[model samples]
Target: MFIPFQPLRTSSLSKKAPTSVGRVVAITGGSGFIGGHLLDALIADDTVSRIYVMDIAPTTRWCEKVTFVYTNLARDVQFEPQQKIDVVYHLAAVSREPGFEWNEYFDINYEGTRRLLKWASKLDIKNIVFTSTGMVFKAGPFHRAPSEVPSADTAYGISKALAEEALSGWQQSKRGRHVAVVRPGAVFGRGCGGNFVNLHRALRLGTFAYIGGPDTVKSCIYVKDLVALMRGAAELKGWHVLHGTYPQAPTIGEICNAFCKVFGWTRVIPTVPLNLALRAAAPLQMLNELGFSNPVHKRRVEKLHYSTDIDGSGLLELNLAPTHSLVEAIQDWRDECAPADPH
Candidate 1:
């Protein structure tokens, strides 16, 4: 659990300064939540000359001067960066929530990643920052502290665990790659519309319900903080893993209470028996898998209990210094749903 989380060297302000204008970079899933935020951050840097946005979905708004490439990385498609790529942020994958078939998850999360990494190496790409999730550490001997144990709760965790292992192994050989692995916990931000977003909206509308008591802890990172970690990772070497999240580690009760505090509403949620929830969730989960919709069945009741403990010593070393507050991520979400400016 203890690792030297410091940067290999001191970073000067200049180094962190924008790369020369017109610097070209590649980002998969650029149209998605985290990806979109990173894209915006990159564009704000005066050093960035150009950004190559690639994803399965089209961007709502793309910079006129940037390059936009569309490709489904899940398939057997070959992808090559058209311009001189400065840094490659690998963020695209499946399993937006869960319930996909074993093969489908493998094809996208595992095989698709393998394809992208191999292509990058072949292209002599050196700077690669991968957006991995913290679930890789699930299935742990639960009840241990995040500071004490590493465990995850799903096959999604296993896929990422294996993927990181493979990537780190490559770095060991001094192969044609240097990687920075960013493992973020639950992420909420604008345009994410992820699993948590629905929950937030549901709770705000007074329709959301939970079986767990208020004390079920959850760890989450704001999308903006995740973007900062990705930028810092571009300057990393070998296999460096860091979690982009808050240290407070709020619980399920705390999350609901926070919503209540912000929205001025409260309702006692009825608890469904765990066994009943599990039995009923399987078929619903299967349906979600078939339709490619995120599954929030009975199994999720257990996920809320996952240890929110995450170490960020590695993040500190990179000087990424996440400045965004975790509450802000949710607050913005609430604002989006609350009301709009009259302008």
Candidate 2:
């Protein structure tokens, strides 16, 4: 059943907004992993009076405060008169590794963003918080500031960088409207999908093998912490372009060892050279190109070695420090979401 948006009072102390202040908010990709978490947060905020969720899919976890508006952002975005949105949280995109058509990335990431911004502009809806990615930067040991010009070597990064540009243009054309583009790291949590989820699953089963040296550092954030940053961004003014990542990231070996300790596993994890694994996974990756769902893709394997060191100092200036430690978040996910038996 479709229910109109309503704000309900809750006793939980709000870290960002004291109240949503009866704002009618809208979110694209509301049924998605990160979007879903943000939706829940909005529903809990008494300051928000209504929420319009525009997505192709439907959400099973419905509430009276949410109204799902079916939208194909790749084509066009339309909403009813009663659903006039005050603020927009654009989270819709095609964000997965392997097997994405070249046009699909542009169609969804670039065109979809353009279409949404145009539609929202027509509605005179100003406040926008777009969820971008840290992948826009080159893969290395370097930490980058949000003010620095972006360099995208991959199609995904290029599409997102273009989208950010479009949003920036829109912000310039208008007055008194703030645009926030948040580039987050590998976000992980219960029910979240990504390489981190796969890694945690393998670790839980004791079937995870070391792919490369332990010294490779990666920037990551808990989904809840990332969501908190998003909320903080929405409440702030001016262009909030910042990186949503851990202030202090842990190395791959350290993260893996933490899992072993949490799971009470004394067994020494086996390891393989990065080059050897990539060479072995090449044929499987070729099969993946032929429409096969190969788990071991060369690109996916390379992520094990790539250091995603993102500078999150910009967000600290916004007073949005990451609350949960990586170790604590991983343990919570394992205890709350892991299967009872993984043998």
Candidate 3:
């Protein structure tokens, strides 16, 4: 089950202030996993007067402070905010999910950003915080830095890189225009049904095993920390590209151990050679394509072995530190999943 996207009971931001002195913010993809967390933070912030959410779908949770607008970024839709938007948090993008064609990624990830910039330009909005991915760098056994030239290989990565270029051009077009590009590593938390969720499920089912070895670094950041970084990045002046990940990169083994510890599981996780695992997962991939809902995928198996040791030292320069450690993050996630208290 996924965690519900609701307003956070407590946050780092100050208590709500009167609408007169708060900033009016707009967010794209506010219904998504990361965007939901950002929404929670903004809702708790006293400095934020109102929030306008632009997306095709409505958010599960709603409040008086937030207004949902049915705006499709991929298409040329009429989006005229009633109030002047102070800041825009651009988090909408097509991810590398199954069945998405290259054109879909190009339309939503690349062209959508261009369209958003056009709208922002028209509204005279100066601040924009965009959520890019660490996938913009070539995936391999090397540490990737924010400053290093992006050598993106995947379609999703290429589209985001183009979007970033568009944002850079937008920033350079006018004086006092600020854009903060946040490239985050694997972001995992309660609502994320991605790699970490898959790992947890496989472990609970007694089907998880270390691919190749136990030492491959899997650079990651918690969802809350990532949104916090995005908020902090928006505060900085000028164009800034920041890498969002923990200071210490945790290995796959360490991640698995932390999950086990959180759930109080004692079974030892086995290791399988990469080649053998790939061969085993090939049939499962075929079965999945043939309408069988197989949990195992060849791509996921390969991703487990590849190390993504991204450098997130840029966080230190900006005086932004992640609130939770790996173990702490996993434990917090577990707590979120617990049954609600009955009166």
Instruction: Report the Cα RMSD per candidate.
Output: 9.0, 5.9, 5.4
TM-score of 3: 0.91
lDDT of 3: 0.83
lDDT (tens digit, per residue) of candidate 1 on 1-343: 0112122223321133243447678888887778777877886777777676678876554553355666687765465544568788888877554556666666777777777767766776777788777777752223322243334456676667666766766566665467887778788766666557667667756776564445655667777777877887888766677776665566677777766666577777655555666776788778876885654665575665345556654555567746765555566666654573100
Residue 248 CA displacement from its true place in model 3, Å? 1.7
- Decide which is better by lDDT, 1 or 3: 3
Q: Score residue 12 of candidate 2 by CA lDDT.
A: 17
- Residues 1-343 of candidate 2: C-alpha lDDT, one tens digit per residue: 2233343344211222233448888888988888888887887888888777788887544675666677898787765536456788999998885558777878999999999988988888879999999988877767677787888777788899999999999988879888999999888876686677677678777777777777777778888888899888887776778788877667788888776777776656678898898898898888877978768887778888778877886666668978777778777767766574211
- Distance from true position, residue 5, model 3, in Å? 10
lDDT of each: 0.65, 0.78, 0.83
Instruction: State TM-scores per candidate.
Output: 0.79, 0.89, 0.91
Which should have the higher TM-score, number 1 or number 3? 3
Assess the local accuracy of residue 81 in candidate 2 as a C-alpha lDDT between 0 and 100.
35
